[model samples]
Target: MSKASDLKRITELRRELKRHDELYYRDAQPEIEDREYDRLKAELAELEAVHPELSLIDSPTVRVGDDRVEGFASYQHHLPMQSLDNTYSQDEFFAFVARVEKGLEVDGARFTVEPKIDGVAVSLTYENGAFVRAVTRGNGIEGDDVTENARLIKAIPKRLKGDSIPEIIEIRGEIYMRNEEFERVNALRSEAGLELFKNPRNLAAGTIKMLDRVEVGKRQLDIVLYGLGYCQPSVVSSQSEYHRRLGDWGLPVVEAFWEATGPEEAWQAIEKLDTLRNGFEYPTDGAVIKLDSFDQQDVLGATSKAPRWAIAFKFAAEQAETKLNAITIQVGRTGVLTPVAELEPVQLAGTTVSRATLHNREEMARKDVRAGDFVVIEKAGEIIPAVVRVLTEKRPADSEAFVFPETCPSCGTEVTQLEGEVAVRCVNIECPDQVRGRLEHFASRQCMDIEGLGVAVVEQLVSRGSVSNISDIYRLDYEQVVSLDKFAEKSARNLLAAIEASKRVELWRLLHGLGIPQVGAAAAKDLAKAFGGVRELGEASLEKLVELDGIGEKTASGIVAYFQDERNRAIIDALFEAGMNPKAPERPKEGEAVLAGKTFVITGTLPTMKRDEAKALIESKGGKVSGSVSKKTDFLVAGEAAGSKLTKAESLGVKVIDEATLLEMSQ
Candidate 1:
């Protein structure tokens, strides 16, 4: 290629890399695989090396990707949170070790090897044995302060325990979601018709930065502290000692740790971690190898972007080649048609994998996946199984393109793919598969908290034609339930009693269980609190609904559309008729609307009440509490150490009030 062409290609690569950096760091929504991203970065680095004059100081290769976001206060790190230089090749890893050892003028430097968890890196600060702040690793220098959300994570302790606590310490670690928690959260999302999160890492990253602490608390996030950032009166002299210190403080630490004398032993440790990581609760993508001695690490030092004392060896995603027997479409609770690949049993990532997700019709068409083709399936993030690629050369001679069904396989009703959407849906609400899905969702713990109404029982009820719709559950006869397979008299009574008890559940649960599109538990709670009951909410106008907090135009429209549907209205009427009187939230008195028709944004630590307490108090008196302050905000409830939101509010000319003033106004 000519110099001009190389320059043009370099420009294109920089643009692409910048875009991907935003997606991966700020948005937590990466389109390309990690290896592909690494390859692109490496290519850019190589091209820049060849043409030294073409290199830019602010290039993705030189600078760390910033994860800082608006709405949260920025926290300057005590010590810069630098990233580790990583490689997929063993030779490159060994070269890294050689560089480290050469810098220290030693033959074999002692090192520590631990699982490089695929998670959001964070720095937690503790002052005098008490946890004070948590921040993301944003651009090495500063990051968004996420103390409020971090406080809710049970794994993060509030105070230090055991002996030899430092006056001030900053613990560095990764915040991640467990595989089972991810699955549970996805199941809820799938049931509620919300888009499923791609992986545990993305979900955890997104969850921690969420403005709503209540919503963040719902998703379980775990943390593992292994790195020491900054400690006053430094006591630990080695990496192993640091781990012990972290553990002594009642902090969650890495599950696996290995000591290695050299690069070869470190590689062996990494291989062992690869074999054992699948058994870990959280996802581990690679092994982080660091110099064990603090003195050694200090002597080696770091570059502008990464540390010279440490490097990460990323393991390739575990994959297995399997025969694709067929492609099957499964109808979800919301009637979305999902195509699942049926594969011949093959061992992958320590599990027997016979199926993988094809994602959508667009993905299938893009990949040209066909039935009877030999396909490579990989466990993405070591949690979700997905078809990585099709081995076209090994395809059968008569292989056929898997055709998406034009009609719902369950009800034979014609399926329709909505414009601007990839999901093909069976809109028939009464479709057997959809019914079973809805029944299960309505009975889920997050919904009605119904006991003795698991998947098997729901399947039996649906298959026996005993339950047709959500309301049919309320009408199930005791004798009919008892007659089902394996159901004794005691089991029948329990099931019936549970169904009967569900009638008195919270209004939010009923609203969530209704299978409303785009409305999850949080939205349901907002709606329930604003409108008091389902009947009143159903009768609300779009203008009125949009005026409420958390109710956007699209959600208001969905609510209006739901109520306009005569079938849904009939279901509501039947529910009421069948003795299902859900408990409505307490509404404010007519004279207590002092803060009525106003938007308030709360910031910083309050003198008496917590943020959620303040939010609830505000909501009770006919006022709305928003997550972020803006020009539209009527008041900024400023407290101690009010951060960026307060400054933004002042600039925007929004009124600032103390918590005491807020209390006075509300009264």
Candidate 2:
């Protein structure tokens, strides 16, 4: 982007984020999901990072939380609240312990492991063995004084029970809503004809932020003190001692904790914590491992972001069995139709599981999942729920195989699956399901990003026939939209303004929004760079596309085939006709080809750049990124555990390089 355009986008992002913060923090009402909000914040941070001079002082990245809500008086914290670095793999968790040991210059290190509760962090202050006040962790430096709200929690003691309590001390921990309490609250809301809470964490957060103390009390929120933020006279020598003091003082703590002597033992403790996770009264996403000794923690110190002595070991999602009631086909942003399993609601990983992604028909057939069959389901990474396998013993003898649909379920158009691909796509762009999904995708943070065009709004457009195709978005009549439910003068104008603003989108975003088969965010960027415009791409032969870095033969074929249809080309023309002229791609510099003939594979989490960023960097430097490790792979950019890919590369005799080495070589 040009300097002016970049500045404009940053300004827009700031405005949107501030509005969301108000809804989330003050009103206890969130407009977008957490993942969506994270995406926007990430984009804003990236833009600021790229253009340092353009960064605003009040940018969300530089700060922790938004300003305190009007009703809550702000309280100052003695110590800045810190967040723990997260790891999904056991190898990574062990690596973290190794780092701590290396930093402390010790051979064998002891650590404390406990459940990392999924809840809002709060600070409690005690004076003269009496509970003085409690505050939400607003921005680390200070917090919102939610004393009245915190007082409602029955678990929090008004006075200390033991003489071991210090005169002046502050304890930090989680204020989580118990799973039963969460259900009760939701049931009450349902009886009251109110919207049900999305998740336990959000419900807990919303409950704390509520101005009405009575409402907060009704939820029966609970608190568990974990660590000391500050103390008048140094209280404990280690984390284990601190927990002992908490238990002695009659303060609520975690169910259990393990003391480990080494990395292997620490991992075993983490595994033990995982076993205790699903059985807990409250939700837990991972295990928190902390250094036992305060002196060792002090020696290890902390980064600007997190403490070096601790790390979070996240468990792979929990699995549970449920009946596959039915299989539903969903048309994605791209015309690809995906099979989703309708399940008999069963509790798993802190939330009720109703549906699971079958991924594609191929996966469905591989698992031999059918309606009326009992299946094991797991949340892959505790986010997307997926069907793991079918129970052969429980399957009815009369149960038949699931027939993969050859036609679009919504519009009855014949779906086609291309050679060398699993995705079965609806060729008709005019399919209502495709149109709605595409519109939602186009307005997504990664695409054109028209704010206010969410799933609900898109549903209204599709159902009312106000918009039937992508180009119809630009032609939305103001009067027609305002006639739809929930739309008033202000919202109608705002949505129209957003739609108008999306016309000036980047070429890569436009390409991604178009949803070409086998083309994702990265492939879209590659195609955009190789071709000046959609017309140029539409005319490009397969040979020209295959020559580009990261553009595999399969992706090249997809692009060529996507444009082969007149309906697809017409949509491109219609977009231009509607004034949404996307910017052309900026070509790479002439002489910056340091990694000309290299093929790289990245695994695990990198120390600095993300995998996508690394891939982009390598591609721009005239190198290529392969999905898997093979003899053809010239370099494997290994990070941390590096996982099975690194092992495969090593066995295949493929050269491996760290991020540092790769960066040095590129330079």
Candidate 3:
């Protein structure tokens, strides 16, 4: 093909691919088969390879498909995305309506009720009918720049479809991954031996901040614009008109929107939404009620952080009464002791919940939770299963007040609760519970990433006394591992290989693997970046550590106390002597294109590369991968069977890309 013709063909191909992407990712309707989609992608890749000049950054063939981002830059919303005040009872709802009416100086004011999507809020800016930027509602003023990622979302139009496009438009909406899509993504991650995300919303939030644009292109994220931020050549005079016009601009508005004339009608609408929330593909936390008139909205104005014109009526958390059969203490990787309430198996929301976490001694005391007491359990954010309240009226007469355990349940060692902390912890480094917890943390996906060292293996090693500490994990023999139940020669070899591979882990991973209190993966990275290696971190004074951005006095004290422990010091020495070389801190060089500030999320199946391969490539370039898509995701890497992520990418208008193009760009 001639150079000009080739360029024309490439543009045509990209346009066609973008259309297909809109249908599949944004609209949740795919007219083409997976093979057909792949064929089109392959053709685009071939053309782009031949005429690299025609390959644009926003090209469908060039984005990362279905990879997660590392972190998000906080965006302060120009108009704060303030949460609305809510009421669970009819009286409060009526009172709120009366208050709104009184404040507006109107005898009767209509209210528009929309589903409160249980997702992250984001703002999208379009300039001259072309998509320009996307940002998360950080503190409600400034947000991370996620323009490239947002463009990948098929649901969000790259260019206005109609002539009514505003010169400058800032659209506000929720970015959510559907329940089924979240499950599918997590399942795929599990199959790939990666950590599963907790829920759809978190996954959505986590996916949007990725730096690798190619990875963002893959996840098929979506968005639904609900409100207008700042607009030039304004299209509407009222909030209701804005909602009506949003559909014309090819933006997805709330499914059920109603304008109620009074409190009764608003309450009725809220009730209807509550009942219908379960039917929608995405989860809704509650209903958002806003003043229908723009003039009236202006009259009511806003608070320092929230708008007086809008209010979010949150739904009461789903609660179920279950008998507490037993109480058990579990030790976490960081040696913090947690109380667990084993209950009679009860179905909650959609899943069977048999246990609920009792967050700490303080939470238990606050709730007056006791053994044999009938308790009400609820899922916090419909994600974590937890106990909310205790029913004193249903308490058995013989039941006694539950006391926090004074000793480690596994090792019979004394446990202590530190001052200013709610968690009572087992301080013994060699305690069997502590050892198992530490080993599990060491082998976790975020740490050393040993593939085969699952909870079963860790349990076996602890029970058999084959491993007494984190360092002893490196000393485990293949013969001993194979001799354990459910072990085979091949499995043992693979486990050993994974363990051996873990020895060369970076200093950040090593620090996280240490299972230090108050030190999370992010904090571990910060510490590594500051101290260079574990030895240096161990030797650093509390005052020196507290000077770091995220590390405070509490965290500093925790680190110092951990290093001072003789047993911990010995374990560190042993790990150092075991041929492990902690990586030195890498300083960001001047003008380095090290994915300076970006996040990514990967979804579905890539055609040519394994997920890990793509992740390694992104990380090598100084970018971070996350498990879910969110307003924060800079890119969504979408592939075959790309489910809700595509929809979320579309709804949020996150950038979506394929595999071959990602490889070419990485070079």
Q: Model 2 — which ten-residue stretch has the worst lDDT?
A: 56-65
Residue-wise lDDT of candidate 3 within 285-393, one digit each (tens)?
7888888988788898875436777777767767789998888999876668999999998988767899998888888888888888888998635555788888899
The predictions' CA RMSDs to the true structure, in order, are 9.9, 14.2, 18.0
The per-residue C-alpha lDDT of model 3 at residue 585 equals 54
Q: Count the backbone clashes (under 3 Å) in each candidate.
A: 0, 0, 92
lDDT for model 2 comes to 0.78
Please give the distance, in angstroms, between residue 115's alpha carbon in candidate 3 and its true position after superposition.
0.9
Which candidate comes out best when scored by lDDT? 1
- Go through the candidates in order and give each one's C-alpha lDDT: 0.84, 0.78, 0.73
> Candidates' TM-scores?
0.67, 0.54, 0.67
Score candidate 3 by TM-score against the native: 0.67
Q: Model 2: residues >4 Å from true position, as ranges?
A: 1-109, 114-259, 262-283, 288-316, 380-382, 526-532, 536-541, 583-667
- Which residue pairs collide in model 2, if any? none
Winner of 2 and 3 under lDDT: 2
lDDT of 1 by residue, 1-667 (tens): 8778888778768767766776778767776667777788788888889887666322332257878764587766878799887788899998998998889999989999999999999999999899999989986666889999999999999999987888999999999998889989989765533446778898998899887788898999999998899999797999988988888899999999999999899999999998898889888889999999999898988765688899888888789999999899989899998888999999986668898988888899999999898999987454558898999999888787788899999999999988867899999989999999998888875578676787777888899998898899988898998887767888789888988999998899999899887676657877887887898989999999887755667779999999989999999999999999898877678898777778898877679876657877887898888655545589999887675567677777889999899889888
